[model samples]
Target: MNDDSRKAGGADQDPFFMRDPEKLAANLARTIEEAGKAAGFWSRARESGMVSDSSFDPFADMLRVFSALGQYWFSEPSRSFEAQTRLFTAYMGVWMRSMQELTGQAEPDKPEAKRPDKRFHDPEWVQNPFFSSLRQIYEVTARWAEELVERADTLDDLTRLKARFYVRQIIDAMAPTNFVVTNPAVLRETLKSNGDNLVRGMQMFAEDLREGGGIPRLRQSDLGAFEVGENLATTPGKVVARNDLAEIIQYAPSTGKVLKRPLLIVPPWINKFYILDLNEKRSFIRWAVSQGHTVFVISWANPDERHRDKDWDAYIGEGIEFALDTIKARTGEDEVNAIGYCVGGTLLSAALALMAETGDQRIASATLLTTQVDFADAGDLKVFIDEEQLQALEEAMERKGYLEGGRIAMAFNMLRARDLIWPYVVNNYMRGEPPLPFDMLYWNSDSTNLAAANHSYYLRNCYLENNLARGRAELRGRKLRLSSVKIPIFNLATADDHIAPALSVYNGSRLFGGPVEFVLSGSGHIAGVVNPPAQRKYRYWIGEVHEEGFERWLETAEETEGSWWPHWQQWIEAQGNETVAARSFGPDEEALDDAPGKYVRKRV
Candidate 1:
């Protein structure tokens, strides 16, 4: 890092850039020398009529299928003349667009004119004629490839899914912005730094190659900007209870007279729980405390091979079940208001159903944020799920008895490539600049691993089979059903959420046999939930509870100006009448430290 940034330090104190000028300079020299060779290769490739980004060959995708089949001699792919014809037509269309571009009268991409894809939203993309044409034609080609694969008659669903997966991956990889020669931003950065950026980008790439097994996940220096308890999850709280399965945290109440019923937050174990409890400015935990509600959250164990056998039954039994018990015991309340985010909400729903079946009516109400119990339309994530894919994932997990965190992260990141993936590539690898320290992103890069059996069970039962929505899912030998959940449900779905897909969350709420007040937040998964009134950022919509679907609700629902947290507080507060004095914090044991807790610091 530069001398100034080096002293900026870790998350303990506020730090910004995690860059070193000297190392960056040395790395850029070597990077430029290699890039010189790659540029030569690109010139030759251009002469050969291979117009594309990426240092590697791009045309292999069409014929790449043949190479795969040839490698597996015994395997055969059914021929589809129609599929071939469609692809040929797509190529011809691309050529026509290219010809138009040469004549300086490129036909406007009509489909995109109606509704443009945000993937190429950068002003520089269209600001340059060459880049604009490249982007338009590339997108046209990508859409065609994805559609044709989806409509392929000869390919099995799994094969087709995998093909589409590869198609998107290839398209994302080939974006003009990825190359320094093509990207204006990178070019400017290169010029400004006088080759330092190039050196830093190469060093970053090499470091990623060494540490990430070829895929650079996060800027390590940027990640070092924030420590868990000190900066990120710095809310005042105590690990009131801990178990082998999870850590139950009860945040100190900010109010004098708190709600009679404690609020229990069940965050998705796919991620750490601190997402809802990050910095105090945006912390839902701190917000809840300030709203006069005693908040409790589950800090899931970062599972390793030793915890491989843990399954659906175990998560339902030991995860939420244990948290509920601990919250009830500690708060001296028989029943508590439960809140779940993403998969944590899903698990909480399952546990609540199991509790209902067994006559444990300990939950007075439930709130689900960007979570779905129904997986009938689980969005793009379904592409990586099914018997075939699950088997493949299982085999991979078998190697370590746990699903690799990065591999799992890839599927989610793919959902919004432009937002999650590419910006990092440009910033860290292209500009030789590290990320600006942001709390939400810090929590995002800080990922946790998943157990083999638990993940498999979740996929097979939830995503692949759609058992949870059907009310046929079973946990711990008990027939579980969302219909069994009778608590007043506060269902929050983000309008722009790619992960939960507001519609899916809306669909899941229908399975519940209770009065569910559905609220549609303004943005995607994390931002939608992290909406604080202070920012006045995105607006949310809320409709009357009815049988109509999401689209209909959007048409008729009332739009609200700011954050939905206040609305939620009003709704939740109405659930109970009396209030009691706030309770104290801290666990009886010594291991678990302040707010963020030790479990969050446990990285895989």
Candidate 2:
């Protein structure tokens, strides 16, 4: 038997190998022999199926043959041939060394010498007469097939006799490059505009290629600091309350007596809360402020190892609970509207559940954006949540005391390997492109680590067991059930979202026994929420609340187009008082400078 086959067996005995050698060898031989037989059979079958004197188009056949040859040459196996050869040689050497050690023939502590260098140019092993003859035969056959394909004249002849063989090769040769169809004049103008710029771009791409890969530049010209209009009146806004980890930033109308209640915005700790209040034109928070409604947003403190034991419960207790009481103290109101995004929404749901169990109906309304409650259908995250993978992750986090943001980013990148990995590799390394500076990519790269305890618990309980969906998730010895929360809910989901698929986000509606307005928006997870009114490309779908299963709701829901944000704004406004007011839920603290507080400046 061949060496590759002979070495395939008893791989389990050697954990690394994990296969049987003799069986593997036999299989390989059988496969090669069968492939040869199949090729011959197909050739005969084709001849038998065709009528005699069938128009033989040698040109078309030649093209097919050449294309096939090119394809074979450029395929993954061919590209990786040298690397695979080196890997196999190294593996064999390691195995030999291991066996020698086991037999007491080699000293365990002795390091082996470096392997001798070998080159494909050498005429040692490959100089065999048998191999030379086989190589000649292969070349001749390939050439003859190519000549046959290329000689074909008619399209019909090519299609019937030679198209399949050559088409694949043509595709392979053209595959790596991206092509955009446009007017020839426009294309030519674009190419000629700046030769120097093109040269520089190519050089930069080459540099990136050498470095490994390049990141795509996200459009950031439209993004900047918040800009409030001159006509917009400034209001009396303050930090109505401060907690152990956060401060509530509240804004109210400057000219009027305040409404009794207020709106509370809960943003995910993963990013700064400023996303809602980005600028005058796009800021949803600022828009709410302009509408004269009382607004209070939770600013989460940046955490470190000192906060290692802080879990979901602490977030609810010190974060949301603290803010709720502070708002109450400022306004003297028992209930207020709450809006939560992503992880914040998750925590809000839990808090609402806890409050319901204790008969505390303090939440007048609830809005969840891109939040997940039922993790059973959490989508792409499923790849990394298996028991063994989780255990390995836990061990890794245990070593570091926390899970680094970089590790989390890596996991996310894996989900979109082609877009995230391959494009970068080709652009940076092969095409020689420069690094593109993009704010979105920058923020995405700016990851925050998760505490070991919190991460482990979240993965095991929420993701693996789907505990929240099953009503088995517990916090602080209190059973947290989604059904307990009966408040009016506005749930927003995004199409083209990778993190939370729209259907999965709709699960929140089923989990909560309340009036639900499921709104589907255009764009991805982040962009969908950050969508400004001026952008014309986006659209949304509004579905009536259905108490039935997520699948059933989808079946019954009608499709619509346009931004869901407007619908959301209208719905949320309807639930609250329409009159203008300078409202505060609790007593104000010492004045804080602006909307985005100190917590946002903290490094992730």
Candidate 3:
């Protein structure tokens, strides 16, 4: 290669740049052999009845979408003609633009009028005629496909929602940026490295497939850089209690005077509890401790097949209730304030109902962060929940005795594939580059398997049936009603949350038979909730719950600058600001482990 080629292929331009044609060919051959081996392994597993045929098929919802589209198109010839004409018209515009550009007669495209897309941000995507046309073609086709689903009036609301979601996934997967030939960046890297990038990418692909046990598990972060207690979950605390379902960590006080009423945090079992204790800078646990409150976080056990029968009853009884009992024992306080995030918040809400029924009043006030008791409008996550899909999921979970953690991770990733999946694919596989070490991404990648009974109940009652909202949800042979739980409740919802919509959370706030304070935070699920006052990023809104709707309430709500952490602190303090000398795990108390306990360290 000449000096110009070397300059183009420099390490500064492409991190994975290397000049070794022999090694590239060898790596390519090995990758091909690995692919063949993986195919054979899957084929043999299927033949042996270890894997079902349906497992090999694409998502059934995708097929249902095509079926619906086919019915719509075949119902009338002009319907199909109209769709084709629309697509062709879009193509004609692209072709004319390309020709105009080629002849130096084209006017600049209206960038502001176009949809904001990160994938097409590369200058070559617009400057190069070939790539510009390809980008236009993909965008046009994607829009057309979505329009067909929207126009299919015969399909029901749920089916149409699923169709639109699946259609987006399909279109996203087919984006020009995902392919080597069409992506200028990847193509440039390929040329610069003399196919070395592809060779390394293939190797990485094979490794991921191997690690995932035949499934491609793309690395979201540099896993080697972060560990649970060492760097990520480095909060100072002690495991004061351990049960089959969880370990209760009582965080060491950062202040001399702590709140008399200790605070217990219930985190989602789907992922590690350390999300709240990621690092010193971002650790909510540490921050809460510093805010003159005794913090106790539930570190849920990463369950396996042995925990298959552990249901919501077990989680509540052996998890939340157990923590309450422990807090009372250690602190000599019965009235403890509590906060729950995501599914943990949902589980806590149910437990509160159960507790109300039994006349157990250990909890004085409740704070639910981005929780949805009513799943009617549970955002895009609902697309994966239907009768057929639920049954399939149940059967699969039954076989393994637990649902694979990666399944949940992949579902969330798909909801934003353009950001999560494809970007990682292009970066890690296409470019043969390692993902940057990020604490949040590290926590996201660290998934936890869900016990069969617990997971099944959550899906059916919460997602599919929307039982909790309707007062039909049951726990421990008793029907639990949200209205029965009359306690001071703080309900928080993120404006841009995808898993739990802000409007759904707003509606849920009305379900609780209590004085509810609904707060709207500025970002999505994790960032919005974990936001610290120190960061001074993102705004929050507080307002009276409007009978009209969330949007109406937003119009009249009081907007406050910076993180919601300080506001929440003030609210909790309002509950009861009386403080006492800080408490710690006594020498006599049995300590199972340090903070960021063993349960979180258990890999799925």
Q: Which predicted model would earn the best TM-score?
A: 3
lDDT of 2 by residue, 75-143 (tens): 656444644454456556645655665566874422113522121112311332222232333333444
Q: Please give the distance, in angstroms, between residue 488's alpha carbon in candidate 3 and its true position after superposition.
A: 1.1
Predicted structure 1: lDDT: 0.75
Q: What is the total number of backbone clashes in candidate 3?
A: 0
Candidate order, TM-score descending: 3, 1, 2
Error of 3 at 70 (Å): 2.5
Please provide TM-scores, in order, for all candidate models, with all chains considered together. Answer: 0.80, 0.60, 0.94
* lDDT pick, better of 1 and 3: 3
Ranking by lDDT: 3, 1, 2
**Candidate 2 TM-score over all chains jointly:** 0.60
Q: In candidate 3, what are the lDDT values of residues 1-604, reduced to their tens digit?
A: 3335647767655433455668657766765775676576556655765445474234766887689878988789998899889999999998998899888898635333547888888876676677778888888899898899888989987878888888899999999999987898998887666666776777777777666555567799998999888998898888989988889999888888999999999999888888888888888888899988899999988988899999999999999999999998889998999999999999999999999989999999999999999998887888888887888888888887888777778888888888889999999888989899998998898888899999989999999999999999999778889999898999999988988899999999999998899999999989998898889899999999868987799899999999988888888988899999999667676687888789889775
lDDT of each: 0.75, 0.59, 0.85
lDDT of 1 at 342: 93
Q: Which ranges of candidate 2 are over 4 A from the true structure?
A: 1-244, 252-260, 420-439, 547-560, 578-580, 583-589
Our model 2 lands, by Cα RMSD against the true structure, at: 23.5
